[model samples]
Target: MITAIVVALLFAMLVIGTPVALALAVSGSLGLYMMGGTPMLMGILETTPLSTASSYELITIPMFILMAEFVVLSGVADDLFDAAAAWIGRLRGGLAMATALAGAGFGAISGSSTASAATLSSTTIPAMLRQGYEPKLATGVVAISGTLAMLIPPSIALILYGIIADVNIGDLLIGGVIPGLLVTLTIILTVAFLVWQDPARAPAGRSYTLREKLSKLRVVAPLLLLFLLVTGTIYSGIATPTEASGIGAFGALVLVALARRLSFGAVRASLLRSAEATCMILFIVLGAHIFGYFFTLTRTTNDLVALIGTLEVSRWAILAIIMVGYLILGCFMDQIAILILTVPIVLPVIQSLGFDPVWFGVLVVVTAEVGMVTPPLGLNAFVVARYTRRPLGEIFGGILPHFWAHLIVIALIAAFPAIVTWLPSTMGR
Candidate 1:
């Protein structure tokens, strides 16, 4: 009953719009106090904050953010987007399709949905509007495609899940590569199909020569190199995740200079943004640890396992039930909050069922991608709406069809877990 009350309070705090970190901290602290009084609460809170904050792996959080910030401001992403437009803007709905492709490129670097959505929406929407594309088509594509940021490598969501679930972070990241590419392909195919059926939505585009396309690729070379550097080093076991991030940050600086895009102003702004993002992520991590401590004290995992055992259902059915629960939560809550709150509780059950941690981590991220595009609480959708000054309803309308693309990708992964598992298994463990 007490565990039930604590869970209810936590959900209440979330529903009332308290920051996720604060909601977690308050509910956790309360549970600790109730369990063993003031001294216990103080001990748990004090140690958790320190230990969680001091993790060496945490250093990469700031570094990754810094790399993304510098890359965003370096004008490289705009170059890439323009290049994509030049390459594929000739088909019906080609511009919108290019925007989604560009979202994938930017996502590969940023590992952030909001950054991908805002950046692409600002650049793509205006151009698409000028070209006579429908507003909903333009906005919806950006919102849904931006979610690829979390699916692709160096993903902040995957990093958090790997940490929380005690999986190999590098393996988890590598595992996302195939599924991420599959999602990108599906989105592109969806765009082509939509455009083919209704040419009125997006007018036929002008063709570009092969020479022109190759020439445009020259401008975005450095950004591609940086991706190879970071991801390659990790895959080859030449650098740890943290070291790769540091190198990536340095690589970003070099690219900015070589491209004649560096300025003190950009550097300062990037630093400020990185600092702010790092603090927010760290606070959530700290709060999760605090909440996890209290949750363990209540022995919830054991209870949950016992409850599951009572049901004579197959473990596969149980997995489906969990996925459905996550999807429902995705429609209403923040993805990161859902991840932090649930991983600790489910890790034991997952192990009991003999599920692979890395594969499960990929599925967790895929499910979160659905939330990034869903209505009412889709962060990427909201970012697009705010930046484009469109009604949230219109954006949600645009998102509806593309949303199924996300579900299809998830279903594909669920049917063939090997898509996620094979790459990680090849990694040098």
Candidate 2:
């Protein structure tokens, strides 16, 4: 009863538009106080914040953010889009395909959905529009493609899940590579199908000379090198994720310098933005830890898992229900908030059923991707709409095909968990 009450209170706060971190912290503290009085409350307040905030792995967040910021400042996203256009621009729906390719490449470096969406919106949308692509197709492709960052290596979502679930961060990151690529392929195929069905939606782009395409590759080499430097070290056991983050940050800075795009103002802005984002994430982590303590004290996860074990249904059925629940939640909540809030509750249940947590993590991020383009609270859709000045309806409409494509990718991973786990198994060190 008390556990239900606390959960209700948490949702009540959320429904009332309270900040997620504060909602979690407040409900958790209340639960702790009610269950154990002042002693428990004092103990939690005294220890949770310091421990959560002081996690060394936390350093990776800010460094990666800084790296992304520097890369953004250097305007590499524009170059990536141009390069993608040069290579694939002549195919049917080619410009939209280029957007997907560019988005995947940017996602590799940026690890941010909204950032990817905004950048693609600015660079790709205009070109697609000028090429006579329908507004819905142009905006929809950008919105959905932007979500690739959530599952790609150096992904912020994957890193956060690793820290929260106590999984191997590097292995978790490597695990996402194949799934991410599969998602990229699916999105591209979805674009082709859309164009095939309605040739009027997206016109073919002009062809470029092979030499011009080769030249464009040179401009993207620095980004590819940076991705290799960051991910390769982690895969080869040469650096931990934290160390790679620092290396990535430095590499991005060097790239900016070589491109002659570095400025004092850019550096300051990057630091400020990175610091702000880090603080926000850490605070959410702190809140999640507090709520987690309260939830554990109540034995809710164990009780739920025990209850689940007695059910007559197959594990797969229960898994389907859970996935559906997440899809619904995605429509209403922020993905990171969903991660910190639900992972603690759902992971033990998943493990009890013999599901791999790493595979489940990839599924969670993919569901988040679905949420980003879905209606009501599709954050990526909103970002695309905001940046491209497109009607929200068109943005949502455009994403419908890709949204189904996301569902298909999720089903593929669910059926063949090896798609997510195999790469990680082969990683060095």
Residue 259 C-alpha lDDT in model 2? 80
Q: Taking the tens digit of each residue's C-alpha lDDT, what string does model 1 give over 115-213?
A: 888898889999998989988888988898888889787788888888888778888878989988898888888878887788788987788899999
Clashes by residue pair, model 2? none
* Best by the lDDT measure: 2
What lDDT tens digits, residue by residue, belong to model 2 across residues 34-86? 99999999999998888997899988899888888887888899999999998
The alpha-carbon root-mean-square deviation between model 2 and the true structure, to one decimal in Å, is 0.8
lDDT of all predictions, in order shown? 0.85, 0.91
Highest TM-score scorer: 2
Displacement of the residue 317 alpha carbon in candidate 1, Å? 1.6
lDDT score for candidate 1 against the true structure: 0.85
* CA deviation > 4 Å runs, candidate 2: none
Worst 10 residues of 2 by lDDT: 106-115
Question: lDDT score, residue 394, model 2?
Answer: 86
For candidate 1, give the lDDT of residue 339.
93
Clash pairs detected, candidate 1: none
